[model samples]
Target chain A: MSVTTIAPPANPVERFLRTDRMPHIWCPGCGIGTTVNCFTRALIDAKIDLDHLAIVSGIGCSGRVAGYVRLDSFHTTHGRAIPFATGLKLANPKLQVVVYSGDGDLAAIGGNHLIHAARRNVDLKVICVNNLIYAMTGGQTAPTTPGQVVTSTNPYGTFDTSFNLPHLVEAAGAVYVARWTTYHVRQLSRAIAEIFQKPGFSFIEIISPCPTLYQRRNKMGDGLDTMKYYKEKSKVKNGAPTSEVGLDKQGEIIVGKFVDRARPDYRELMVNQMHESLGSRFIDPVAAECEEGEPQGCEEGLCS
Target chain B: MNADPRGVLSGTHFLDGDHACCEGALAAGARFSAGYPITPSTEIVERFSSRIPTVGGTFIQMEDELAASIAIQGAVWGGAKAFTVTSGPGFSLMMEHIGYAVMTETPCVFIDVQRGGPSTGLPTLPAQSDMMQARWGSHGDYSLIALSPNSPQECFDLTITAFNLSERYRTPVMLMMDEVVGHMTEKVVIPEADKIEVEPRRHTKKSPAEFLPYEPAEDGVPEMVHAGEGFRFHVTGLTHDERGYPSMTPQTQDKLVRRLRSKIDGANRQIGLYEAEGLDDAEVVVVSYGITSRVAQRAIELARVRGIRVGKLRLITVWPFPEQLIRTLAKRVTAFVVPELNLGQVVLEIERSAGSHAHTISVPHAGGNVHRPEQILDAILEAAK
Candidate 1:
């Protein structure tokens, strides 16, 4: 009797990814892929219409995520992803816009945009994968590099104070804020799904590994060793004040869903303020333009 | 295509060039704009912010020029005719994003209300100094369309043309307006929507399976699909293949860059727009654009009374340089008298095109002010000699 082998079911997340574009440019043992895996899972769990999802990225290793995902993606210039996504979200309020980029791309070069987008509370979801170094440019010192970490630009260890991303964005008025690691895939994916359902500027900072340049140069071991460290050191502190959650070299890692509150987003304020001032004369242009309203999401709190 | 009637203001109004440009954008169906407040150009956005609410669109004051520049591109990909306004300093900050727009073939407009620059030299003064920058400001080998308007009426008219060109070509179009035209108040008649022409975006007719994001039609321009259109297209600043995936090979680079340039260059005959007067029997031809063109017209009049057979060629489409016209004009004319607010920017192109056939005289101005008609009249007289 001839034995027959049946192929197991294809991974559900594969449908969400552009597997043909793989193997991605990411290096061996890079945690970016792991974070991407979680993001795809989050997209599945959220049950968002795949057609209505758009991903924008800036220049960096993490910026390459736009190419790997099977969504309407844009790989824009460095430091402008948030504003780009802001325009995208405002132009077509029905689309779920997400900005995926790295610490250097977001916190260093794009810091102003990050704060302003949060301040306006534009309806966008930003995923910042902080690897503590600019891994794409051969490990330059990033704004989020821990004190005393040796990077390519800082041979004697970095003396610059790092950004507590959650604290910064929370203070800037992001309605939802969270922190997790590549190790906490389940929890991180859940947090990402939550941001999709929420309706304002939401941010999640994922602590990922850069074994090629960051870990090897700093003697922090490889990708597996970094995961071991995360498992041992991470403290699951839900509702922890953002100010106390700063990362450091060989220190406690705080990871959890930190801030969850409601505030009117940029679009809401624009519509509400304009409607009150202009009265019946004002029609929501996006709504007025669409004939069938097939991609409809503009009608929220317009009359009231 | 007919414009959306809701956006049309449909009445005569005494308006500044900046405000008229805003009305033109609305009439042309630009529902999104992002800008930062910079002098001269700020009035464009100031008018837009208040007017857009009534028109049913969105206007944002971004954190800076960099944000403003890229934000409009985001809106363009999201299925809206979009633009951003800025002056010299802001325009300089927007160069990288301009390159990004070109690389991705994102259709949009950038309005640079020209001012004295090389760094914030004069905030409220006129200068045509940005003409060369408008052509080659962004780093790369690429081509773009730029329109220069001399008055508030043309400002209102050319801005609509800019939007149509951007959509038709799927490239960024620059409206290179000087501070004089931007701030000058004049009579501008707002035509009804039925009278106005707008180009609807070239969305693909092919199904998602047959569409390749970067594949060009016969015109060398690709059709666009908005973000939520189920096409799932990818656009990147990196050199890309027909599928919109990054293909870093030099072969892909050569093919992509060549197409970017050839699309605009090959359409030179159709893209070139100018007003030529007395060129049939003229010894000297005066070339000018923007506010300088209005000044040159006076100079041409003065030269005619002085017995110099002087003609006028007022440029409306400044980029693509109108080289073919200049080459043809050179064969008949003795010399070309080029007067501009800047110190000899466009004159260099005149010299190149008129090589060995005719003399090219540049009437340069440092530009806090317009050229006195006498200054250009003397150049015309000298060119005739």
Candidate 2:
């Protein structure tokens, strides 16, 4: 008997990507695609049920990650990816939910949800690609763009103070917080793997390049040049207080695992509290809780 | 499919409209809800958060209505029946997601227990003012299903209907309740799990290798496969072909947008729900919905008692607006009187349906409580005259 052997895929990374949709919409020398490459690598390395993996992204260049990945993904509305993932995770706790989006979608328009998700410590992995500008809408000003940076909306140079994201998420109660650039692919991918298992809110901010508009207008050089700059300027300080980790326009970019703590995620706290309050009368509503009747030991005004 | 017995509380009980609406959601197969509570609508989620843990689902008190609205859509894509509840102001905040849901052809429910509002006008009061908003609030030329339940029982009944229609058509269904209906307590008999029919998710049967996410069946409705089901498909709010990728040509826009309308519009006849009484040779008719329907019922009784040839048409499905019925009745009736808690909303639909065949009168109220039956009676008398 003769057996036929199939040839191995030439580009291993293509297995995790929707390569047919490529050449992606990302501009030349853009760092989003590079960051996504790291993400797909991390997702593969995590070694979980690929069938149960779900990726959610908001509106932006980074939001395109959800579309490119080979998992069950959602390119949700602007600034709402966190909440959407929140619902998806709570609905099916077994889903390995990941939220990937841009800084503007996460910190600017979706800032409220960002903080509250961290505060609630919802169990999910957030990969925020901070390109320092809103690259999709023609390089507009973003909440993460460093001070005095020029964007379409800020042609006269930005006057608004940017958010210190590592500090923000830590303050908001994320269990794991890390920062990396596309230059730090190995570290970023490693953090990505770690975040998958870290319960509660886990945020990974990848400072990436927007050579098309942001770099051209600001004269920050092309993607590779910016990557070289990140290599020289980034100082890895794992375990440093997040407060000491703000990125300066011309100063060092502090990149590391800044915060990792043990705390109950939203589902854990919610389920535990529900069990404590409602006892055995309560079950996961999606499980076997469909039948209805008066409870044996009912509290006034409860579901019974 | 029948409701899961555990989620279905099969017995008669005294409950408010808000609680009944929540029960209806459970029976309809909704096991996930993301909500930020507002007056009159809070109890729906409050009860859901408690009951869902027992029945086997999850509820999150979202940071705001924006999160609440989109979160449910995410859950839907994650393979769960999901919904969110809010009032007028929260509904306004949710308009963007509603439009997104329409564009993406996601099946979910939006419960708007409306309060008086131009902008939070009456948080604790009743109003049907959102009738127009529910129809056209989301930007773009598209059609959706909107249901109005008059009593606590209908709140349960119509909520299930909303979910069924949403699943059947793969569109977001709106359950429009007023503070009056949401807060009022009454006897509601929930049926056994198997007795209640729900439209299960129309999942695609073809293997993942051959599936096109947005490709509809002959009925102009598409099948949905949840995320994590190994169906590698992309869905966006952008205009796309069957594969659900972004396509920006006017041709794509025309084909896509037209199909969005035609699905619900094509089914408008079947989708339209209303109650008709005493229209054989009636000279005048009263059209109302939600709480105003009940009030109009009272005025209708009085009008018949006074020998005014008046009839009642209570709208259950407000959108797709029972137009054929209104148009046919318009030909026979002297006039149509619309009494609403709003200044004027659904009356416009009636007028359009009536055209010049019959006079259309609107009995508008600013909506703190409800329309006084006498006010509706007076309007009927005037329209009759």
Candidate 3:
């Protein structure tokens, strides 16, 4: 008869997660959980204001990041996370807003927003998990699904060429652009943390496994196999030109921080333009939040 | 709740409904807007984009209506009074986010300066075609507020009301306009900032540890908190529990759906805003809204001169349908005449509410323009007989 009170597992990442809703919807050997684990580590290491951090996600398996992250987060409508995060950052420039979504969510239906968000240089950290297929709605052909890859919709294999996201973001004016995989956990975390200090749009594309559908159909085995493949084939070439860093059809994952430069984010540009146009009368909406006597904007329903 | 004097124009100016709507949003403390420029509704955001910088907010021209709609929701969470304006095509695109706002109980406004559609049927012309769409375009079982303004002045007035109702209800409020009103120019007085009463975002006073994001107050509206203020609450479009965590169970779905329905349905009486005239011993009642209400007013006058005892009920708040008023009036009036720019949308609700008590007649007009006073007068005269 042994009556012993055992303590819970002292996992550091548990604090950042809504473990009450654990045993997530992701399939066995899913890489999304690994991405989340890396992100949590990045958040912890960044040592930024957790309260000021707000995560926005679109509809997908990766979109569940907002639900799990113990932060001011929003799981918005599909493919609108970038613009939503743009609004969040612009509305309150003090907020460290992040858009975490999937390839189907970000690069397909959300592609326009992704490019425009980059163009505007909205201060947002965007983490796009590319499983190379629409895993949530079944193995539908995603914009990132490599050519000749068979999907639910494309049994004949997709003819469309996949987007090189790091190149796309860099070309669209992102101040920071990086690519990593679930296998590159430490580098991904460091890269994610580095982007925390950078201004303007920062993008990190995580190439992950879709074992249940993508791997099963493609005959690429499971997530562990994908991780092993990444470990063996992934090339880390930091500061490589974005144009030349695109993934090859031969399964060589070109992983690196391809671009990092200084640029005024959307808020700074707005504030500057407003100061020039409206002069002293331009009571910055973000600044207005800190004023004591100047009719507090967030009262009642006036959001800020 | 006075508006920030800086944002308020605070003077009389000849303005169109679209422009007036913009000023109204500004006066009501809207500091952020995300929009896609579409016909009729473009002027609202066009004016807002230029004016917002002066007033200290953000105006983002999103790539599409879907992004625009959801962007405002994010801005709302980030502590900004936010909105988006669009025409019919854009409205259709925004339907998804409208449902999302309802599901998440986020406060925002969507101004639809309606153009003819079934698929871009008329981009530049007026239509009341989206009346039913405004009420039910968004999927799922949730209730929302919709207001119609007849004149540029009412446009200014009701846009503020729409924002206030959105704040009070914690739902996306629709400002349903037509091309005529949206494009028509008229004198609109911008009231003093202190004179305009605006509802402050009802922020939760409870500490973050004690707060449940979806937990409702007596009014069935949960108090809100903005992002970056240390309230690490979650909001989603999914069926969520009081903690704002998604719950897919039947019990959770039933509780959430019922509350969504009852919150607006039960408060229809209080939410209803309409003007009723000539009800006593009236043989006919003319029911209309938006620009049609103006034409209906003329028709009601012409019918009165013709000795037709026609009463007028000009609806200002359209959704939640003012069902009780229509039912009660049906018991008294001999007949009810509904004239709308669209062919029989709100008329369906009118007929349903009238039931067997009164004869319901719809004077339908298919898009492109407002009804001729004669057409409505003829309906009123026929109903009176």
The global C-alpha lDDT for each of the candidates, from Candidate 1 onward, is 0.91, 0.87, 0.88
Estimate, for each residue in A1-304, the C-alpha lDDT of model 1 and write its tens digit.
Answer: 9999999999878887888898788888788999989999988898888988999999999999999999999999998899999899988888899999999999989999999999999999999999999988899999999999999899999999999999999999999999999999999999999999999999999999999999999999999999999999999999999999999988999999899999999988988898799898887866665543543554542323
Residue A258, model 2: Cα distance from true site in angstroms: 1.0
Candidate 3's DockQ is 0.71
Better of 1 and 2 by lDDT: 1
Q: Which residue runs of candidate 2 sit more than 4 Å off their true CA positions?
A: A1-9, A285-304
Ranking of predictions according to lDDT: 1, 3, 2
The DockQ for candidate 2, computed on C-alphas, is: 0.57
Q: Which of the CAPRI classes, incorrect, acceptable, medium or high, describes model 2?
A: medium
Residue by residue across B220-297, what tens digits does model 1's lDDT show?
Answer: 999888999899889999999999999999999999999999999999887889998999999999999999999999
Show where candidate 3 strays beyond 4 Å.
A1-9, A248-250, A292-304
lDDT of 3 at A206: 96
Task: For candidate 2, give fnat to 2 decimals.
Answer: 0.70
lDDT of 3 by residue, B204-232 (tens): 89999898898988978889988977888
